[model samples]
Target chain A: MKCARCLEDTAAKVADAPDGSGAWEIYLCSRCNYSWRTTEEEEVINPEKRDPYFTLDGVDMDDLMVLVPVPPLKK
Target chain B: MGCMPACKFKPLNNKRKNQGVNNLYRDLREFLAKLEEEGQLVRYTDEILPEPDVRHICRASGDMPNGPAVLMNNIKGYKGKRLVVNVHGSWANHALSFGMDKDTSPKEQFHELCNRWDNYPGEVKFVDNAPCQEVVIKDDINLFDLLPLYRINPYDGGYYFGKGNVISQDPDEPDNLDKENVGIYRMQVQGKDIIGMQALAFHDISIQLAKVEAENKPLPVAIALGVDPVLSFIASTPIYYDQSEYKFAAALNGIPQELTKAVTSNINVPAGAEFVLEGEIIPRQRFPEGPFGEFPGSYSGIRKQVRIKVKAITHRKDPIFENLYIGRPWTEADFLLGLNTCVPLYRQLKETMPEVEAVNALYQHGLTAIIATGNRFGGYAKSVAMRVASTPHGISYCKNIILVDDDVDPFDLMQVMWALSTRVRADKDVIVIPHTPGMPLDPASEPPGMGNKLIIDATSPAPPDSVMREVRMVDRMPQALEVEKIIAELQKSAGK
Candidate 1:
């Protein structure tokens, strides 16, 4: 399955419903790390139905900036 | 207008039981019971989706001025789990968190909090056993199976623990109890046992993490979920680095805070928390984190943040997962961070300038602050505004400062507008300093953490300034107070 946000095929099943009723399954995209459940609404699970502002299509993974730069290891 | 005889009315404290200071709650369950008793909590038992339904209801609650805290009992996918949001959304609920009367005004609550600020560094009691440890999961722990996680905003990248209080001690001074920090930072669920935390550069956790990273070692952290109401408030407060939040929580509630040690680490956590995730922040490790809806009513761009590897998860049976909904203005984030932001700034300002009356830093966690102070000299108000920009929390968060007269209550926007409209001469009253350190979550920051600071001096000019000539002010008639008393009595009788 392709991720709804990044449109990558890195989506893989993370967990299923704890009740063992086959109710829902959670999927996480390894590329962009967007996680969603199958039972969620179309806007959150389906790529076509997601908001355009949040979609990461055609975005470069290396372009994201680091919020806090990692400091050097002490000698 | 004719003068009326002076009515002998006592002060606010002399009238009631000091606004119910003895009603200290120990846990979220106790606080929820009190909220339900006060008609400030609402329960929805219908089965609902975790995504849009819960977020939509919480956003709608933010639209209401006096919305009740919502408790959803029956979620479709999760069978026995429960979720509560907006517990600190409205002024009424915010007042109830302090054990104050539900009808207490925000200004009165602000003053009460300020009055309690004098009693700093209260005691914390360590207990042997806690309910949070009733059920422990150390092997093969999965967050999705435990927490009823859901996206708060439609554009959020993933589910977030928006209200968790992260407790950590300084790596350099691990034995110093006063240096222990309990703060609220946004953590997103990346995998079953992995969490991505946004420890901003200015936050206390970042300072501790930096020290640990210098030695290339993991920083121990304990994430406390569904803490007591007062603990949530104190966690979000930006107090001095050396001050302990547990002690502040005790002082604010006029009682001692209860704490317990985590299973894997010596870090003390609130014993009343519903769940505790004992983890270690892997030093020098960064991963993609955000696009979460921030307090500034904007979506933070995706950035590489630190990752936490959970070692264990402990919780009380049938735990209620608490989350905060933050989007546009006036959401639960505003109320949660409102007066806690004000009291520290007010206390710091009073230390140097005793003439400062009150501070209203309710907007966006004090990116903008409204201060009321007395004019000691020609440009005293400007000096007060500059001092506000230099305080510990003010350095990064306070970008806009509005100074008004002591007579004008900073909590009332109408009075502030009147002062701004009548007293401010734009050329002389408005001052702007360029390239100041600012909060990165603020969208207006050019380089994400650097921006300009603005000060609007709305106080009346004293001697030698002479911006205005022969200013005449109108005073309220003595009969007005008598009329107010009469109208209050009439409204009470009519049940208005």
Candidate 2:
């Protein structure tokens, strides 16, 4: 990773830490000792690889035609 | 309105000897005191009994913020021995510790973390050796001889190494030594001679570690028992793959992180570390471990995991063992993994799904994560949801992904659930996808190493879906200024 400061090539890695009781992962580089998370190699998946037909609610994708805003309660 | 100064870094030199090293806190009292002074920590000096520490604290403390990082230095049983427990186990403390804004939403915090990553410059101030080297157990060491490693929650198979940074430098990537190849993975203790490495293959660190194994070389490893709050934070988050974790920490600390090389391995460690254990990962080492409390809120019994051979144990002269609990609700499980990794990760995902509004990692500890976004018609939420679940980090453990409207706070389980209840028809809005890489710690692992994941499209559907005409009402928390007025009046009346 290029050092954000000197732009010199350096060894770095993120440190494991707790951001309170919430969740967080810290990034750190060993060479220049810099820390931060970058969007460079991040992968975000809605459903993991080899997803099945049903979701957490047991709903299928092909046949479902759901409504938006969801009608309010009858009561 | 904006983030603090961006993270910065500087090059290290072998020319410097005995320069400045972080003041390593060997004593539990000193560690707490330092944290308090820096405002990165608080202490409860409250007296609490042992037998029920896990049940009493983790069960009741899940939702409270600003909880003293929890150091029960004085315990009734197990001969006192000064057991250091409860450090960084609250949501507010998480923010305060990192100098983040408490008023900022979790989703916003995640965004700032991502922004911080963009300008972060990893830094390391090298010193010959510091406190972690103050007391070294080079030859052979007994596990039980040191601090009390608690069996948190009843079903725990045994006392685990719940506290410690299991670090490994990529042996195959000597050329990639710009701090980009270092990794601090968490390992669970299985025996005096074994600990579990629950790394998923998708983790770049794990993938690199595998490369070392394939090359048949012992993977050099070190575990720092205690470190300054920010340094510890660096090890846990998914900031950047090529960037150094410590530099990210420096960015957070707004200062250079001091480092000293490990006596055994070539890996550099935080100089302020209370204790550092140096070792190596042997290839194909198997052990029967677990039955420990997982984030799923269950005792996942005996699973196959890698067994680590204890090498040398090194620490300050009188090191106090830090015991962090797991299982049930509000444990460090969510603190370090769920809450911490989620924020920065939410930002990284936005790089792909730019319109995504916010994200939250549920209490299920990586197994369940939620994301909220503004719908742009034509499967926008679904596509973004897919990317979120597919993120290298998310693929490993996140299942049960929920996408909600921007009006909903992904971090707020209530709002997410509300979207699921009102906008979702169970059979319609809910979109299911499965069979992805999962947490090795997850009990649902299929035979021959296979697992499944599902995403529930809980977002409000595209416009003109016939349901857009539906009316909905949502409640908001009281404003901060109003609450402040009441508190100020109460304080003044009491004073007068």
Using TM-score as the measure, which candidate wins?
1
i-RMS for every candidate (Å) is: 1.1, 22.9
* Span of ten consecutive residues with least summed lDDT in model 1 chain B: B1-10
Instruction: State each model's CA lDDT, in order.
Output: 0.88, 0.56
TM-score of each: 0.96, 0.71
Interface RMSD of 1: 1.1
TM-score of 2: 0.71
**Quick one: best lDDT, which candidate?**
1
Could you tell me which 10 consecutive residues in candidate 1 chain A have the lowest summed lDDT? A15-24
Q: What's the distance in Å from true for residue A52, model 1?
A: 3.4
Docking class of 2: incorrect
